[model samples]
Target: MVDNQSREMAATDPSAELVRLINGYQISQALHVAATLGVADHLKDGSQPSDTLARACSAHPASLYRLLRALAAVGVFHEAEGRRFSLTPLGTCLTGDALGSRLDYARWVGTPGMWQSWGNLLHGIRTGEGAAGFTCAVEAWTYRDQHPEERAVFDAAMTALSRAEARAVTEAYDFGHFGCTVDVGGGEGHLLKAILLACPDARGILFDQPQVAVTAEGVFASAGLTQRCQVAAGNFFQAVPGAGDAYIMKAVLHDWDEGDATEILRSCRRVMPATATLLAIERVVGPPNQDPSGKSFDLNMLVQYGALERTAQEFQVLLNSSGFDLVGVIPTYSPLSIIVGRPAPAA
Candidate 1:
């Protein structure tokens, strides 16, 4: 009784596919563990026995061996012999050592902290309230503000991500025209440093809160930008440093509701000279049925911050309400597009 349905079912078994899907979570956890343990650094050039690797990382041999085997199967490492594994090119990069590594970002995103908040996404959808309750009953910034250990992890991941994004923003934008610039909410000043390196004549300001300014000093000193760039520890919601020709905010406005986003913009508007321009770098959500990054990020804002990504039309409305109008939008080399607006000339 070899029916066609029976034959097809036998040829394409479902168990393996289901198992692969079910175990995808383990891949994320394993990579997180690998990054935490510095396995990629150890395995960079060659292979090592599981027992030896465990000793180096100070973990149990059997537990470490299991993780290594799991990671190896997924192409992060190569199981060459009985218990020795070598780092594949993919594996070494998972250590957050690459030019544009998302390794630490992945770790932070998949950690229990963010994972549990995302677990409450349904609540966000139903109530229109964000997942602050699930995320330590605090906003993302507030969570980092309270927990020092978590803050360090978050800061490290953010710095890495910012550095990677900086290259694209620097190369894509024309900074030559601007004599001076300021990066608002520019944690660690990497973005400002990159912009300074790109625009030789441009001196700069890195205006962020007091806690953030401490981190900026280290970055500025490292980049030798302390002489050219002024790191001002202040609140952007209160005011922005009014000296720069151009004021920039990256991935900042989308975290706020439209009203708050406008307030922030208006603050910049208030501090600016009539000729000063504003550059807000954000993901411009395209039309519906377009599967762009902003679409998913919009929902992320919905769950995480009670915010949403804006279409260009939406941005125009906000800009006009804030006493500025969208002069034009520039597409940059990064995922972020530059929304260039200016204060009213005279009217």
Candidate 2:
């Protein structure tokens, strides 16, 4: 299917893709702003005059209208009368009493450093590097270290993403068989806490970097899970504590490439008991458009990190290299699927 004419137009038309891509950032940024401002939450009943919203939010009326208008133009929200806007279907995804409300995640994405790193999409494609090191024009991890506020956003965003899935995963899996469970690279201990709450017999440990571990204290106490949950702080690159009868890592493996991902898995393998289970719950991509979120997130991984959301077969290969065998892939209520594997028995 060589379309000579279409190819020629695409080659010659410089503005076609770039225009949308550039403006697409604006759309995302606008959604972030609107979500942060609780614009959709206010419009849950119906549209109101722009001035009223501006006064409520302590923002300028004209500027507020401009932001709403721009968001409405993108179909995130809808406008009926002049300067009056409300939630669209897409906007509603950011609202309601849903577990994974986009509010926290939306705000997190617009946070300065996270937003700035995404601008390096071109760097990921051109250089094929994480572009993580360049954030400071000097040392790597500098941006994350220097900006604890942005890191808080990142933590909240991860928690926001895992919210609905955490509950879903907890219910979908039968943890009645396990004694202790460790969540490796578990951001803020949200998912593990969800699992432990669901299966009270299961004791949980949260393993993450020191900074993120600080957040677990609050989440644990708030959930009244302080008695059941243990928080451990360290890098998974070196080792993972082998304290659990089963290990679960949701949405963590996809953030790294094969080498690094394999390393983390191997570290888990080192810690996991011979009889323990390893679960990698991730967006298992299939044929194009068969699943929207998985496919879309595949590109997100490429553009943001130097990794990928992978297929089940791909997950198997990485797990195999790390001293585990693919056991099964379990589909849950969410877009993510669980890829289960377990290590060879110890002598």
Candidate 3:
């Protein structure tokens, strides 16, 4: 006879998994609410009665208890005696003070702009245009530019994301050889700071738009790299800093379609010494039925920016068009990969 566990597994309803997948948004929104209310931060010390948490969060006592109980059911928090709740290991990721905290990313996902764009994903699929442009009547970047509050949240989200990946990227690749590393479109300089920290002998140029690059000074200062790093403000489409031994564009090219991406690369090429190396740090889409995370990110890119995550072959083609020869793709512990390239031979 089959064992009890095997029988139970066999008896499970197939539709149950589909139902959970369909209701995934509920969990996302719940996590967003907790992050916004700083619930995880409050629970960092120890378990507290739901009413106490409610007061701390300025939320309705009974309602907060319900939310806590629900999150407990989902393994985000552990509900104890007397309706007290404590953060589970999974929940610690929502704490703002924690290393690799995803608080800002959760907040960004629940922001109005992101919700509106994803809600209109069908429109993008049907029209071959970004849902953000269709729904917001402006491109996503322009929308953020118009709303300072949203822009701040978006920037924090990007920095949080970069912080989570920076260590893995640095560990997977060696940057010690390059004397000067220029991070093209490096917002807030998280990755550059990490690289500088890892390679004590190397200096860096943090380059981005004026508004974005200006905020990186504090990041460098906090890392004690103020003297070694220079913040350069400019548009990557127009120009990038020159005289760097290595150039990095992390999570940058995926924000644009092929034409715009190639132009950005060409701008870096225009100034890069033939000896300098270029690294495009991004997700390399895997073959069919694999790399689900990358494939899902590709869909989000379509909805939000009318762009995509590329396959290895696509990256090679893109590099060739932009005056670079593909060297090799280096994998990191994280989902992102380092696509190494060099300037094509002079014709």
Highest lDDT, which number?
3
Write model 2 residue lDDT over 1-347, tens digit each, in one string. 85999878876787876776667778878878887787877877887888988887788899989998887777988878766777788888777354467777888778766676677767867877664544445322466568877766665666677788887787778876888888898887778888888787778889999977988879999999999888999999999888688898988898889999989998899877778999888889987658766886776676556679998889888887889989999988888788989995544
In model 2, pairs of residues that clash are: none
Candidate with the larger TM-score of 1 and 3 = 3
| lDDT: the better of candidates 1 and 2 | 1
The order by descending TM-score is 3, 1, 2
Better of 2 and 3 by TM-score: 3
| Residue 98 lDDT (model 3) | 85
Per-candidate TM equals 0.85, 0.83, 0.94
Off by over 4 Å in 1: 1-24, 286-294, 345-347
**Candidate models: Cα lDDT each:** 0.82, 0.80, 0.93
Candidate 1 lDDT, tens digit per residue, 93-203? 776567666678666766665667777888888888777555568776677667777677777887887887788778778887988898888878888899998888889
Task: Give the least accurate 10-residue stretch of model 2, judged by summed lDDT.
Answer: 132-141
Encode model 3's per-residue lDDT on 1-347: one tens digit a residue: 87998757755867766787789988888888888899999998999999999999999999888888888989999998999899998899899978888899998988888988999999999988999999899999999988888888888888888988999999999999999999999988999999999999999999998887888999999989999999999888899989999999999999999999999999999999999999999999999989989999999999889999999999999999999999999999989999999999888
Off by over 4 Å in 3: 1-11
